[model samples]
Target: MVRERKFSDEDLFLATKELLLDYGYEGFTFGLLAERLGVSRSALYKYFGNKEELIMEFMMYELDQFMDKLRKINDYNRFEDQFDYLLELLMNHPQIHQLIEIGRHVPVNNQKLKEKNDKLDGLHLDMYQSLVGFVQQGKGEGKLKPHIPDTLIVGYILQSFLVPNFAQIPHSEWVQSIKEIIRNGMFTDDH
Candidate 1:
């Protein structure tokens, strides 16, 4: 007889995110996920046809959570506060940018995968638009320099997450350095 599912979809997605981050796309496997979740491979197959579909679904769920958090940045009154909050949020999810990069290259072989990919693309666009809106708000408040393009600022912020941690600096110090570089630029005011 087929066994009932003990874990919810959210639990599976959370575990999948952890595994994907631990082992990149090339290394991730259904067997590993099933093992990690304490379920058989057949149990996982019931929800997703293949690894690609499962990963895509997880990406969609993650993006949804991310967008929800992004929208909440407006709750803060000051743009600087919002910027700090955004930075903290990004720092907390170190693997998200990598996952997004992987998602871009994931092949969509079937109609369902195609539809899911389109939805993921839409979520990505919404996330970008939310960032642009945040930038615009900062500009309106005269906190962000009007001379800089919104896309450039957004790109810089997003790419900052991918900065190499080769030095093994403390997380707080590293994040502070990033905030300083992004907000103040690399040049000293004394120059």
Candidate 2:
């Protein structure tokens, strides 16, 4: 039987965040984390049991932070402003962007990890829905074309935000271009 070990969840979270940032998702591992913490392999195992749990924990932490940031933008009365804020938040967290990219392509062996991914998917779907609601609102206010479906607009915005090769372009410039495109293409004439 494996003995459980106690470690600071905050420490583990920060360690995992730094590891994912430094090594990216593909290169991050428990052994590397243990080495960083100057702990033995067994000690690391006692704390996390496996890498998948660590990754999921980190993902959840990031998701919570993301939602919190979104919630704080309650003052933005316009959908375009909210969308721009969302883009800005994502652009600032490129490591998380990379982690998500890694998560999408990597295969997982555990059911819990799969479930966590499902939950993450649901969370993202909810965010997309919120954005679509804004788009629908814009349509009602004659701020967007009624002909364009909400799903397509949301999907396009997501694709623009989550591109795999974001490291190549300066994020500020990319964001500006994205905002410009979204304004010209999606926002209503009043924009």
State the lDDT of candidate 1 residue by residue for 36-143, as single tens digits.
Answer: 888898899888889899999999989888888878898998888899899999998766778898788788899999999999999999888889989999999988
Error of 1 at 12 (Å): 2.5
lDDT of 2: 0.70
Clashes by residue pair, model 2: 143-188
Instruction: State in Å the error of residue 98, model 1.
Output: 1.7
Q: Which stretches of model 2 miss by more than 4 angstroms?
A: 1-11, 18-26, 73-75, 95-98, 105-118, 161-174, 185-191
lDDT: worst 10-residue window of model 2:
94-103
Local distance difference test scores for all models: 0.89, 0.70
Off by over 4 Å in 1: 1-7
Instruction: Identify the candidate with maximal lDDT.
Output: 1
**TM-score per model over all chains:** 0.86, 0.66
Model 2 / residue 189 / CA error / Å: 14
RMSD for each model, in Å, please? 2.4, 5.5
Over 122-190, each residue of candidate 2 has an lDDT whose tens digit, in order, gives 766665566677678678778788898888876666566655654677766777877778778545688
lDDT of 1: 0.89
